[model samples]
Target: MKFPEVVSVEQADQYEQVIDVRSPAEFALDHYPGAINCPVLDNEERIVVGTLYKQVSVFEAKKVGAALVARNIAKHLDEQFSKNPKEWTPLIYCWRGGNRSGAMTHILRQVGWRASQLDGGYKAFRRQVINELEILPGRFQWRVLSGETGSAKSRVLEGLAAAGAQVLDLEALACHKGSVLGILPDQPQPAQKMFETRIWDVLRKLDPARPVFVEAESKKVGQLRVPEHLFEQMTQHSTVFRIQASVAARVDFLIEDYHYFLADTDTLKQQLRHLVTLHGHEVIHHWCQQVDAAQWPELVGDLLVRHYDPAYLKSSNNLFTGFATAHPLPADKLDGPGIARLVDQLLNLQG
Candidate 1:
């Protein structure tokens, strides 16, 4: 059977299915946003093939690799593609629009499905991501929520989203809260390319005419860096909404919001260790002791005053041009009702 014609990454949505025929590790690194991983060569198998290609002849390597690819593709056909009708159309791609994708496209086409390869494969999609990141962020009008740690900016962003305001929750997407202690339990951050793909997905969905409400964030959120162009647009073009809440109120909010820390004192202490260089061993040790003693409020209050607030103030003042004349909205508490009131105020300001 003949192989199908290649399609661009931009045309991915036109197909009913998007299959990534790369190794699992490659897919984990990045692929088309919704592409399903149906690896023709898994990590270990890929290593074996590469080793054979270098040590043995290319002919010998292809012979062994072909068997492995056939077996895996057959398994996918029986297990994953069995339900598809003859009319099922899928877009397929590998690392570089090469043999891995071509094999799958040929097989699926032989089965009477209209399967097409992604031209330039994942590489093309990556190049598109790079181009979009450079230009797409500038297309949106952004409204940024800026505040100290525990000031309920995330909650406010959620409230804005729930209130039907277009919102971009970068921390949520990154699965980290943009802090030393922000690592989510059991959830690892996505690979850098995956992170960029997620951003591109969201950016593409947004209406450029409408303003996107986003939280103020540092360039890096945990282990992943925000795309340079998006970060630039966020810092330079955003109209800042500064949330106002007292230290005590913020502490109360944190105690309620981050109650997971109370249950996992050891983890909290370990995260606190990261701050030792900035706050010094003596201060971190004291904070750890406070955690050990179960003095939640006191520990949170001290961290807010000593560590988070000063750092936030310095960075926000220096980095965000709109910080000086930011619109102030009082957040008496970080509860639903309080956030709802703030959302109303925000919408009214926009109106």
Candidate 2:
């Protein structure tokens, strides 16, 4: 049969195909980057085996499992693996680098291909991801850019990236803006596992000899958790750049970014209600009435001063007191060109 040795995490990067032999449900929850699910046992079959493992003897479980495994493998060879040649090397894994992978590896080998199993299965791979996030910081340099909600931090990162500056756009990788309104217009945010994959892919492409620019963010970005290793690196290797704009200019920037406000009043009302407790009932009531009257500028001004601005100022004052450096953009009469100039200036700064 198809007996194989375990492949380490470092070795995983070199593999062409990463096959996950877990049920589709398990694969949906989270899986190794680049892994495609080709379950040797579907969910119901796995549950049956697991129940047998508890109620019956190991020999009994193996007897039932063997039959299910054989049927599934034949189906896989017929439906999926039939296209690939005998020489294709595939890295296969399951939840614990156990029977599922062993079964698949054996089947693949029977077809004359060189295949391997990931050591420890997906769990071991996850451990490596956690360890990399926790321990691998002393080796690289980082630059962090800090600003309030409408400070154009994402745009600055994009500009820096365009100019060949080493840049890590965490929000872009996570597919969310790291805020309530951070959702993109038409695209859905990626699953957390996919987010990690995107981050890892970008990191692999970077030149460690150059400094990387990233935006400041809490560990959680919308629904995704920032990888611990990368977050740890940001905590220390980071040099911060602060961008400043006046209340009016920031309001304009926010309005431009959130076009949903232009089309739906109900959506705007729901978003506004999320801030009611922070702004207090009476003030929020006034804003609500004003909004219904279509007083956009008045509503924005009050919300900025009474809500978003105060919160941002408090956070900026408390956490970024000793920022690496700060720069001010245009105050009155601000526009895209002025913002672009500010971004250019911030990118010019070296850590």
Candidate 3:
């Protein structure tokens, strides 16, 4: 039998299964992409061993921690790996390629399955993600798709992706719609570290030769900020496309898109309250009255003209210099068929 190999984060994907042996809390924060959590020391057990390490002697701590690690590894062998073939190779990692993963690797190798531990473990993986995110955004040819709310920019972006165009959808990654009213009801955004990992995951697979379509998003999406270098690259160099649709089309699209708030006027009123400082209490209160009366068209029209349009114009012009001369692509139809046509138009667009 041979000693287990030591692998690095970059080569982790070549393994049949990448096993994360960190505590659940550590795994939840972030781990290597496609990694499975089979923690050697779970949450409570880790704390117990940590306390003993501090208060008791090193020998005492190792005795307890070793017993715990042994039991967990045995449990994994029986419950998780029982059905695997002898040829199955797995990559394992802990906080810093230390005793936890080393113990698992040694045991698995003893079982005649090829198992390896990651060098520098999760810390090394995170550093890789950080370093890649720093420069990856510049590698792509970016087409900044800009539009006011309800222009169906998000929907069109989805269509573009389905139609075989490379797309970097920031709002989708952030699990938000990217506005004061953008929070998804059932979807929560990932933690910042996990978010960066996901971004890096998508970028590393994309070819730099293709143009990646993305929305004109602000620095922050919901509570998460775009990686600094990414935001900088997006704002500095890109072909900007300004999508135009009639105000009526926008209103109709918004009512359908935000149907959740329409049914829950209390939520709609609360969201409107957030806009009081910008549009003044009187205008906001008037919009609330429209909400209570189920006057969506009137309320939505007022918002687009008063709130969404002006704010988008100001921000887009300020952040993207190309916005002053953005290519205007008009789509009065925002329905399913219209989105399809828009996708065709986007693929055929020239600078």
lDDT of 2 by residue, 155-206 (tens): 7788778877888898988777877556666668777776776676677667
RMSD of each: 1.9, 3.6, 2.2
User: What TM-score would every model get versus the actual structure?
Assistant: 0.97, 0.83, 0.94
lDDT of 3 at 58: 78
Query: Which prediction has more favorable lDDT, 1 or 3?
Result: 1
Tell me how many clashing residue pairs each candidate has.
0, 2, 0
Question: Total clashes, candidate 3?
Answer: 0
True-vs-predicted CA distance for residue 216, candidate 1, Å: 0.5
Q: Best candidate per TM-score, number?
A: 1
Candidate 2 vs candidate 3: the lDDT winner is 3
Who wins the lDDT comparison?
1
Clashing pairs in 1: none
Pairing residues by index, what is the TM-score of model 3?
A: 0.94
Instruction: For model 2, give the 10-residue run with minimal summed lDDT.
Output: 324-333
lDDT of 3 by residue, 74-150 (tens): 99999999999999999999998999999999999999998999999888888889999988998888899998889
Instruction: Report clash pairs, candidate 3.
Output: none
